[model samples]
Target: MTVAKLAAAPRTAVAPEPTGPVLSCAGLVKRFAQRTAVDGIGFQVDAGEIYGLLGPNGAGKTTTIKMVCGLLDADAGVVTIGGRPLAELSVRALVGYVPQDIALYPDLTARENLAFLGRLYGLRAGLLDERIAEALELTGLSDRDKDRVEAYSGGMKRRLNIAAGLLHHPKLLVLDEPTVGVDPQSRHAILERVQALGDSGMAVVYTTHYMEEADRVCDRVGIIDRGRLIAEGTKRQLVSRLGEKDRIDLVASGDLQALAASMRGVTGVESAAAAADRVHVVAADGRSVLPDLVEAAERSGATLTSVEVSEADLESVFLNLTGTALRE
Candidate 1:
């Protein structure tokens, strides 16, 4: 569901001058009970940029966004938008936050839903109607604007959720796992819209567990885990962090963790970690290490279906840094 963090705030009459990064935050930390949920995570998103917070679930993606949206105060550090502190009520209105869950009214038609939420942000008659039509078209729901939310498919509902987020035309949009369970086609549509938003100069913070999603839609990605940001860069730059290393993927069954452990003992392998259905290994020499890896897998009682070797990629970077897969 959308948090509507900005919906109730008083709107500012003038947009901030775009002279710097549209959103910037640093040294953000948050803790609950005895455990830290977000630890010293920081990044900046300029206008016309899509910055993805790449991480597995509970890696503090949601918690960090909450602080950024001013839904939760940071235990330390600060967040600024367009060079203005988030503590200012007027500045909060400049953020559009679309949460992972759906928040539309089931009985309302798509047009009605937009009209309702649009008014919550102080939109007026003519402008509200125009924004409703625009948001529906932007989300590819203009053809179904008269359809009730209850009758729409899962993907359609997800898209409408995004439309509701755009009514205010905020400078920055924070999307938390926006494509979690949609069909492939709808997911594709959503990604296209996100890319379009970036091209049109909206600073977006997108968070997801899917590595491919991060690779496809994000301009730069920040890999976060265990409440800390481990790495941040573009796809090519992040991959370069693995410098000259080759990655091997062994798709197999049975005791994958043991197989990974066995590979870790091999001379050439730099690292190994087991994930669902496979084990990932990095080495200086990919082809030459295959024989040793096969023997190790056999000794671990694992059955190999296929094996592949390639230069380092985003997956390789994650495996190298965390000793775990992206979906772990």
Candidate 2:
């Protein structure tokens, strides 16, 4: 598989503008034997929207993603792309999926791998070369296309895997943990390209357990846990819905209960509770009330070790709703 002359691609066929959501799923459920891997998961992703499925490992993010991509059958639910049910084989062509695992032949050069995969997507010889070149360029791998996959860095392979997914120019892209196990630099590069694609009117469903990744990249987020979608909204909307304010972690030795009591008495504090060696405080204004909390702690004979204050964010919202951390 070789492109002797990599010329500029001819005018690529652009997917038609979506009249409705690019992807929609309702009451999606999947079970493997006795365990239900996905339960009642539903969401919508519009053209140019990057919807993130945020959950920890085994939280059914991947299972839900598979169902959305039509790669796995759902036990119950309906998925529609562009107002058509997923049962239509032709509609499946509207989606490009990149699984968590790298899907590439180790011995094949980047160009060779893409050429082979493009053919599988039914791209003809002339259009195939153009698509491959465009995909490589989008993934920042144009210069390395001649190199074998075995010689590419983990990040490069990840990017190349993404490039292959884009070869046929699917309107909706589903990526499962695209940055997992990648170096920070490469992860940033991959994320940048995903953002670019979203900007170019491609709908994207991205799944990740990394809190910061979801926060940084997603236009809206669906928080899934125990195989259920607990919440879905923009970060701001989710946090606002939970009524979370600033969160402060007051760490001290002595009696944490006493520290918590003091914190609870602070005027701006919305709530305070003692968990282990720390006192968690929610306040309308954390910084403004920190001085008072410190004084109260000192008066209660609790020596303050450290104090951390952060405005309301997805982490706090997740903790409030699920009673656990997002990564856990």
Candidate 3:
């Protein structure tokens, strides 16, 4: 497929006024029985920017989105849109939400579904019709507007879901795992559309478990785990958090823990741990630390068939800070 045009006509015909943040959540918390699902998480999305919430399963991403959209009341904290508290009914109209699951009627045609949703947002006859057409075209589903939801592919359904959210031209769009289970082609298309939306100056809050997706699409990412934010920054800034340390991986057949213990005492090596068949080591300088690791392995009576060392990446940073894999 061809790359979607990054440079397009500006979103608004009129000049945009300088403004404050379009969306903000501060000290947000949610609880279910005995567990805290969202624990005082906070972030802001500026107008015309994309902010991604990234984490593994059960990380409270969905809960956070629900609170922001006013679908669920926060146990504590506040959500604001365009400087107005979310408790105001007017703020709800300014925010559009696209959930992970498909929310359209399976029996309705694409255009019909959009028109129905548009009406709910208070769009009337001629205006609703026009908005429906624009949303369908923007999502690349204009040609399939007459198709029934059940007849559409997973990706097509996802596009239509997004289109439904855009029916009223919301100032802020909240998307939760929008590309889950989609084909690579569809995934790329969805990502392109999201970028286009942000380029048009709509603030977006996107949540996903895919690290690469967040890295590629977001201007900045907030990493959440166990209902709390462990880290947040641009990919470069997050990786730079591990600047003083380098990572070394070793592949071996026997006694990995024993080998890790030996490597931990080597000069320049800060820490070492073994998981499965590999030993992961953190050091001040990987190049200066490799020889000592090799000699230590040999002394521990373990055969090290291969070794690799490189600058720390986002995954390593996550592991170092949380003691858990980002994908887990």
Candidate 4:
């Protein structure tokens, strides 16, 4: 993938010596009036790593992140950064939080917005200006620095929001669905920027409902479901949990339901579901079952346009653990 052509800037402020993990959470829990939003969850992120939190909407991912950022207090457990507990105000400085929603002033110019936020972090004078410039260049918005935010495209706004988070040169950046509502190009740019951030030595905690994003960027993934952490590991480690199972996705044009049903009894097939013009089939051996699957589709009057087979992925791992599809 081509990285954005960002202007060269000073190296990200060197972080403290890595005496330990960059971010750590242990038995973190949260509760609302009657809902246990996050329950006894724990994980750690090391410097220069991108840790992905994957879950469906309201699976406690947001709540856990809020607690990690100290925006919400956890009812139980502990969150720490660089060996310091989150309760310490000094720790907040080591963390930069990019919320799910746009947090910039739409009426202000991009430069002004970043400058204002930097000032809040005690940045001033030449140092502040340098930080703002670096952030704009990093997000590929330096040319639009003088443009009012309200006049920018959705992708630009999202990129600017991310730039705001880096103005402080944080050690652990927390991004909550930073690409939720944007064009495909914008999402790709954001993901590329995030990967670059990790490559540059900053730890990042990225949360998203998008499975492909997690697969592409995360060094490690934690799957959360119904307020519980179901699994946590690298993609290879998680997929290994699927054992010998294979995942087959077939894009068909007609009678998907009947096609799904037809494939359920295919030799070696374990389960099948059809929705959104695709059929997802799990089998003992995808290669061995491909012919049967194609024959089943043909017998059921479904026209297959595309087919993909893999041993397992983050999506299949999620489904295996939660008993539901990742997007559902």
Candidate 5:
């Protein structure tokens, strides 16, 4: 299906040249009564780029996005878009936000919902109609535009929610956990659409707990945890921070701690630990130490069901930095 490209904003007769990132947040800090939800987090998203905020729940991703959208005030920070401070009303219009929860009215048809939201953005009749049509087409929901939200599948509802965000032709799109719960197919569709949005020149900030999703869609990633941005860079850059270590995950049933301890003593093993039901071994060379790990598992009476070896990936990098898995 062909999605219509969003028309770029019209140039004035003598418009000022633009420079810097389309969206930038600096020293963002937020706190509740007694807890700091976000702490001095900062990053930038340029035009036509996808920046993923990779973190687990309670990692401060939501708080940071809320501050960027002006839904919540940051205890300290500055957010800017298109070289204009977010405090300016005009700059707010340049951002589109899609939250984790479905935000459409169940009784309204997708067309009706889009029209209603478009009007809130001051879109006139003709422009509103064009935007509704374009948003539906962009989200692959044109044929089903007349369907009521209550009658749509979870995926359809989610797409409609996104379509609502695009009604005003935002330059930067912030999506928070947009793929939380859905069939794999729907999740795939949502991810594909997000990537398409970036390719079409919209700067996108995607936040997710899924490491694989970040690897798939992000041009760069900022990893957040415990109210702080612990690391920020391209996947390659982040992985490179781990040096030459390789990650070996041994999925075996038995005394995993014992197996981990035994493997840790191997000459090439850098570190070993047991988490969940797996023994995670970091080594200078996983391939060279695989035989030792296998022998250790056997000696510990752990039946080896599977073994996965890989250099540092986003997941391994996260674990190394945070001392916890993303899924945890």
Candidate 6:
């Protein structure tokens, strides 16, 4: 779908000259007493781009976001929104934030909630009403604007939450796990809305642990872990980091650990690990490496029942880099 047809406004404003990145963060660090939350992270989000921060729980994604929004002070590092430091309140006014948890009043109607938030952003009178209507229509909630938030379905509530964020026409939108706990239909709608926002020239920083969501929605992704960025690239680029390593899954009966060790020493094998009934092997090339894998298994007294060779994917890349599965 075209962005102009989806968004309520034009993609960007006409500038006297091309400016620097829409958003830039460098050496961003956040600490809570003795524990470090965000560890010197850095990245940039250009206009009309959707940058995803992906990691498991407690990877400091939320903490990094909080610091960027000025909801929390950074122990060190710098955050700039539209070339201005985040310490500048004016820059904060230009950002739209959607938190992980629902922040609206449950007893209020969707329209009421949007009006309240719009007023907080200094919108008023006819202009505020017009913006609220535009947001409701954009999020497919125009017909349900008078429904109380608590009476709305999970998906509807999420859509309204997003609409509230857009009411002030912020230049940058930061979404923190916006699709969590929603049904598949709701997730799809949310993603479509996010893509529309990005296409309309609003820079976005999306955080989620869902690999599939990140792969589908983000223009580029930064994979953070334990407060450190371990990988950053497009989905294809990140998967390509596994370079020449084809993954093979073998299910067999025998000493799995011993078989895994033997497979690791194979000529073309790069790494191997055993988990329960399955043995995972990464090889230079699966086609040629299969024969050697079988031989290695036989030598280890494994009665191989099945073997499968799959091309390297993001999951495998995550496993290889972190020594743990992304979903774990």
The best candidate by lDDT is 1
Report the lDDT of model 4 for residue 196: 91
Which ten residues in a row are the worst by lDDT in model 2? 1-10
- Residue-wise lDDT of candidate 3 within 1-328, one digit each (tens)? 1112212322221112325898888999999999999999999899878999988789999999999999999999999888888898767778889999999999999999998887777788877787777888888888999989999999999999998987777778999999998999999999988887887778899999887788788888898999998898988998788777798888886888788788879988766777667787877899998998999988998998889997776656666676555552
Which stretches of candidate 2 lie above 4 Å from their native place?
Answer: 1-18, 249-306
Q: After superposition, how far is residue 261 of candidate 3 from its true place, in Å?
A: 10
What is candidate 5's lDDT per residue for 1-328, written digit by digit as tens? Answer: 3432564533222223336899888999999999999999999999889999999889999999999998998899899888888887666678889998998889999999899888877787877887888889878899998988899998888888888888887888999999887889989999998888898788899999999999999999999999999999999999898898899988888987777778878888876767777877777789999998898888889999999998778877887776666763
Best by TM-score: 1
lDDT of 4: 0.87
lDDT for model 6, please: 0.83
Query: In terms of TM-score, which candidate is stronger, 1 or 5?
Result: 1
When sorted by TM-score, best at the front, the candidate numbers are 1, 5, 4, 6, 2, 3
Error of 6 at 180 (Å): 0.6
Q: Write the per-residue lDDT of candidate 6 for residues 43-118, one digit (tens) a residue.
A: 9998899999988889999998888888999889998887888887767767889999889999999999999998
Candidate 3 achieves a global lDDT of: 0.83
Clashes of each: 1, 0, 0, 0, 0, 0
Question: Model 4 off-target regions past 4 Å?
Answer: 1-18, 252-267, 271-275, 287-307
Supply the global lDDT for candidate 5: 0.85
**What clash pairs does model 1 have?**
1-101
Question: TM-scores of all models?
Answer: 0.94, 0.82, 0.82, 0.87, 0.89, 0.84
The list of candidate 3 runs beyond 4 A from truth reads 1-18, 247-310
lDDT on C-alpha atoms for all candidate structures? 0.88, 0.83, 0.83, 0.87, 0.85, 0.83
